[model samples]
Target: AQLNISGNVTIHRGSETLEDSKLVTELHNTEDNAYDIIVTENDDESSSSDEKEEDAKQIEPNRIEEAFQVKYQGTTLETFCSRLKLFHDEWYQQIKPYAPYLTIIQSSGSGKTRLVGELRTKGIYILYICERHECSSGYPASTPYVQKILETIRDYKFGALLSIAIKEIKNKNWSAEEFWNIQIKDDHKAECNDFWRSVFKSLLQQKKPSSDSRDENFVKKLFHKASIVCCIDEAHELLAKATKAKDDETYFVKWRRQIRDISWVGFFNILLSTSGKIGNFLPPVTQDTRSARSHDFVIFPAYLDVNTMDVLAPLAENVGKEYDYTRVVYLGIPLWGSLAQAGVSLINLVHLASQKIRNFSKKNNDHLANLACMACSLSLEVSPRIAEVDSLIASHMATALGVSLDRTSILCTYPSDPILASGALKGIIDVGWENCLDTLLELFSRGVVEAGERGELVNRILFSKAYADAVRECFPDSPVTYLQKVPLKLFLKSLLREEIDGLDELLNRMGIDEAEIGFNHWTSLLATNQKYVESGGMKFLTANLVIEAYHRHTAFKMPLGFPVIDHIIPFKYNAGYGIISIKTRIQKKTTFGAKDISSLIHPLNSFGKWKKGYKILGIYIDLGLDRENAVESKAELKSRNAPQTRSKNKNNEDKKDVKNDYDQIIYIQGVGSFKCCGKEISERLSKILFTRPWPLDTQWSEFDEKTDLKREDVIKTFLPLVFEQKQSLVDKWQLI
Candidate 1:
C-alpha cells in the first residue's frame, strides 16, 4: 500500500509542476466558461420570452400609456389641444389682428390659473404674475417686481434665449443689471442694436418656429417666433395694488410699460385674468385712451353636456344611492359640470339629509318618519335652496300625485320639534308684520309649513302634523277638517301669549327694577287683554280698558279759571244771588228736586252757567255773613258825612287795600276764599292744586312760592287737562 501511495503522489517537485499547471489550466477554463454557460441559458430564456411577448403584443397592443390616461369630463388632452388650436386660429384671425392684449373675465373657480399652467407646459412662453402668490408663505414679498419678472422668465427657460441675445449685444462679460442698462449707439453699435431690436421684434411677432431644433441659434429663433404672454392672474388685485403704490413709476405701471414695449412689436401678448368685472380694475388710460388695445373675453367653465354626464355618472353614483343620473346631471348642468362643485354640493346634501333623517327618526310617528325619508330622498334629487326644491316638487311630485303637500311643512318637519317652525315663523314676523304673509308663503313653499289660502299652516302649530292629526282624530265631530281651518286670529292670540311671556322674560333680564315702569304698564295691559281672550272673546279687547286704566292711574286735576280780584268779587256776588234764585226756582217747581220735576223745570236755570250748584251754595253761605257789614256800610254812606271825614275814611280804606294786596289770597274754584300769608297760602294750596302753570299768575304764585315743583311734574299735571279742555271746547264750538 505504501509503494502504491508513493507512486500516486508523484513526488518529484520540479517534475510535478507540469501536471499541477495542467490541472490549474483546466480549472481556470471551467471557471471562465461558467459565466458563458449562465449567459447562454439567460439568452435562451430571454429569446423565448421575447417571442412570447411579441405574440402577446400582436394579440393585444401595449396600452400602458393609455391605461394611465386621465380624462376631464370625458375629454382627452388631445381633444383640448385641438379645441385650443381652433380657438387660437380664430383669435389670431379675428381678435389678434386688432388687439394684442386680451383681458379674460372669468367667474370664480373657473380654472384660469390651470389654463395658463397648461399653456406654459405646452411650450407657450408665459410670464405668470399670480396675485395669490404674493400672499403665499413661500413668496418673497420684498423682492422687486422687476426681479420677480426676471426670475419667472428664468424659471420658464425664456430667459435663456434672452440672456444669449443680451450677451451677443454686450459682446463682453456683463451682469444682468448691466445688460438691462446697456445702450446701443445708432452708428457705432448698429449691429448690436439691430440684434437686440430683432430679439424683441421676433418675440412680439408671436410666430411659431419653423423647426423644432433646440440648438443655440434655433432656441433664439424659437424665442423670436414664439409669443411671450404675460399672464396677470387675479388681475384686479394686481392692478389695484399696483396703482396704489407710491412710487412715481409704480411696479404695475412699469411692468405695463415693459409689456407694452415688447408687445409693440406685435408678437407679445398680455392676458389679464380677473374674477370680477373687467371694468372695475381697468386703468383709466385703457378706458379713456384705449392705449392698451385690449380685447375682452369672458371665460366660463364648460356647460354640462351629455359627455359630462357620462363622465361624472360613476362619481355621482359613488356619492350615494340617492344621487341618480338624472339628479346628478340636473345639478351638474347648472354648476357648469365642475366636479369639485358637484362633489361639494352632493356632500352638503348628504350631510343635510342625514341630519334630517336623524331628526325625523326622533319624531316617534310613522307618518312623520315616512315624510322625513321622502323629503331626504327628494332633497338629494333637488337643489339646495328651498325655492328650487319647491319648484321641482311642484312641477313633478305635487302636480302628478295631486298631493297638496306643503313644501315648507315638509322642510319644517325635518326638525325634531315643531317649536323650530314656530320660532322661525315668529322670527319672520318679528322682522316685520308686513312680510308675514309673504314669509309664510315662502316657508310653505319651502316645505317648512303647510298653509291654506290665507297662509295658515296645515297644523295650527307649525310642523305639528302629529298633533294636528291627533286633534282631527280626537275631535271627529268638530267642524274643523284641517288644522289650517283654525282661525289665524287664534294663532295671533297664541303669539300674543308668547309675546307676553317674552316681554316678561325681557323684563326679568333687565333686573325688574330697571324696567318697572314699562313692565308694570305692559303687565297690566297684557293681563287685561289675556283675561278678555280667556273669557272667550273673539276679537281683540278694545284699547278702551288700557286707556281707562291709564287715566285712572294718572288721575289729576288742573286749576281752571284765573284768580282775578275783579272776577272774584262778582263771582262771589253772582254765587249768592244764583244760589238764592236756584232755591226759589227749585222750591217753586217742587218740594224736592226729583228727576221727574227737575227735568220739567231747569232748577238751576236762574244760576245760568253755574252748573256747580254746591260751589255757589258755599260762596253764598259765606256771603250771607257779610250782608250785615254791607247794610252798615250802606247806612254810613247815606248819612252824608263831612269832606274831611270822608277823606280820612278814604285814606283808611287805601291802607286796608295795601294790606290786602300784601296778604296771600287763595281762590279755590269750588270752595270759599281763605286768606293767609304768601308762604302759608302756598303750603295749603299746593296740597289741593296739582299743577303749577308756567309763568305763574297770582293763584300759582300763591302755591309755588313755597313748594319745589318740577317742570315736568307741573306740565304732566296741567298740560293733559288743559289740552283736553281745549280739544273739547273746539269740538263743542264746531258742533254749535
Candidate 2:
C-alpha cells in the first residue's frame, strides 16, 4: 500500500537520535530517489512492545515541558493575519477569470510588498521585478528583465502548462540546441536574440496539434490557465522612463506591450504595485480601451484613531500604577485628540514627543521632560487660537510699550490669556493674575523668552512648549489671569492714531476755551471742511474753515477776479478787511478840428463844430457816471487839505472832455499776485464766473435761479484762467 501526505508531514520511524552525515548521504545515493524509500516494522511482538514503552516515556516529558512555555505574546499579529487572509481571498476571486491586469495604488509605508510576499508564500507563483537603476544606462540592461521572466516560467514547477509551451516551441522551426542554449546579451538588440525571438514566434504560432480531445484540452489549458503572476513593484518609474525615452521603439515599451498582449490570451496575470503615479505612465489604450479587462485596487493604511488606541492600551495597563493617572490619561488619550484637531499629523506628533522625551531622559530630568512633552503636544493644539488673537493682543501690548502699533517688534510679542488657553487649547496653567504682565515683560527682557527667525514670539511663559512646564513647576498653585480690558479712550486712540493726520494738534486746538462755539457749530464747521477736502482740496488748513465762513457771510457774491485775504486777520466777525488797486486812463490836453472845409461855407456845415460836444457826452456816458462820482469824491477828499475852489475847477475842466483830441491815449493795467491756501474761496470765485450764462462778457446776476454747480466744474473753469494769466505774465517778463 502507498500513503500520500498533502501538507507538511514528518515521519517518526525510530527514537530521536543524531544521524551521521556520511551514512545519511550513502543511503540517499543507494536509491534512485530517497523520498520513494519505505520502512518496515520489526516482526518480534515482545521487542516492539518494549520499544513503544520507551518511546512513550520519553515523549510525555517533552510534551509537558513544551506546553508550559509561552507560545504567543499578543493578538496584534493574529489580527493582521486574519485581515490579510480576507483581503487575499477577495482579491483572488476578482482577478481569477479574464482579468489581464491588476493595479494596486497605495501610499508609502502601507505594507504593499509585505502583502505580496504573504501571497507568494501561499503557493502563488509570483515573478517579482523592481526598478533598481536606469534601464537605458549601465550594467543591468533591459535584457536581464526579459531573462528573469523566462527563468521564472521555467523554474515554476506547480503546473505542466509552461513545460508544454516550451515543448511546442521546440516542435516548431526552433532547434533544440538554440532553445536551451541561448544566452542574453547586454546590448540594445538583446530582444532580437534567438531566445526571445523563439519565445515570441512560438506564442504567435500556437495551434491545436490534432482534433482529438486530449490534445485540444492541452492546447486550451496552455492558453487559458492563470498559473503565473508577474508582480512589478514601483512600476511607475519603469514605465515612466520608457515613455520619456527618445526612441519610440525602446525595448521596455515593446516588452510591456507584448506582455499585455500575452495577458489578453489568458496565459498569466500582471499585478502592478505603485505609489499612485502609474496613471501618468500607462498608455491611453490601456487606460480607456481596455478598461473592461483592467482592474484597480486602492489600499489606504489603517485608521489613525484605531491604531493609536490599540498601541497605547497595553502601555497604559502596564504603567497605570507608577505614573500619575491624570498625566497618563492626558498623554494616551486627550492629547492625541487635541493635536489631531489642531492639524498636526499623527506620525509627526509621535516623532516630536518621543524626541523631547529622549532628550529630557538624557539630562536626568525625566519629570520635567515628561511635562515638557505634554506641554509641546498641547501647545500645537492652542497655536491656531493664539494666531487668531495675535493682532489684537499685539495692539494692546504696543499701547503699553508706548510704541507705534505697527512696529514689527511690538506686533511680534506673544500675548496669552487664560480664557484662550483654557477654552481653545484645554491647557493647564499655574500663575498669579497680579503682576502677570510685569513678569512676562521681565522674562522677555532677561532672555528667558525667545523669538523665532520671523520675529514672532517663540517662548511664551504661559503656553510655550519650552517654558510652560517650568512656570508650572515654579508656581504650582498660581492662579491664571484673564486678559484685562483696555480703557475705552486708550483703545480708540490706538486705533485712530495712525489714520488721522495731525490728531494731537487738532485735539489741543479743540481743548482751548471755545465755549462760545457750540458743539453743533464746531460739528458743522468740521463737516463742511471734510466736504472741501473730499472735493479735491489740495491741502486741509484751519484757514479753510474761515474762508468758507467769509464766503457765506458775504452772500457768495464775490467778483470774478481772485480775492487776496491776509492770513494775519483774526477769524472774528468784524475783522474782515481787504485792499483793492485800480488803474484808469487820463488825457493831459484837448483840441477841436474840422475834417471838411465845405461845412465852413454852408450854413448847416458851419454848425458841425458843436457836434464835438455831443460826441464827448457820449464818451462820458460810456464810462459809467460812477467814474465821475469817484473822481469828485477824490477831489473833495483832497480839497479838505488844499484850496477847494482850485481843486473843483481842475476836476470840472478835466471831466468836460473825457476824450482828448491832441493828448496821447494811454492805457493803465493793474497786475496783482495772491497766494491762497483755501479751495472754498477759489471755488466761490469760479462759481461767480461760471454762472455768466452764454456770452463770455455777460454780467453775473446774484439772484439767478440756477442750482449750485459741482466742485469739479468750478475747478475746471478756474484752472485754465489762472494758467492763462500765468503764461501771459511769464511771456511779458521774458520780453522785458
lDDT of 2 by residue, 342-454 (tens): 34333333332233222312222232222222222222111212221122221111001112222112212211111122211111222111122233233223333331110
Predicted structure 1: lDDT: 0.27
Compared with the true structure, what per-residue lDDT tens digits does model 1 show for residues 464-550?
222233334445774221212222112222222122223333223323212100000000111124455477632211223222222
Minimum summed lDDT over a 10-residue window in model 1 is located at 515-524
The lDDT per prediction is: 0.27, 0.27
Per-model root-mean-square deviation over C-alphas: 38.8, 39.7
lDDT of 2: 0.27
Model 2 residue pairs with clashes? none
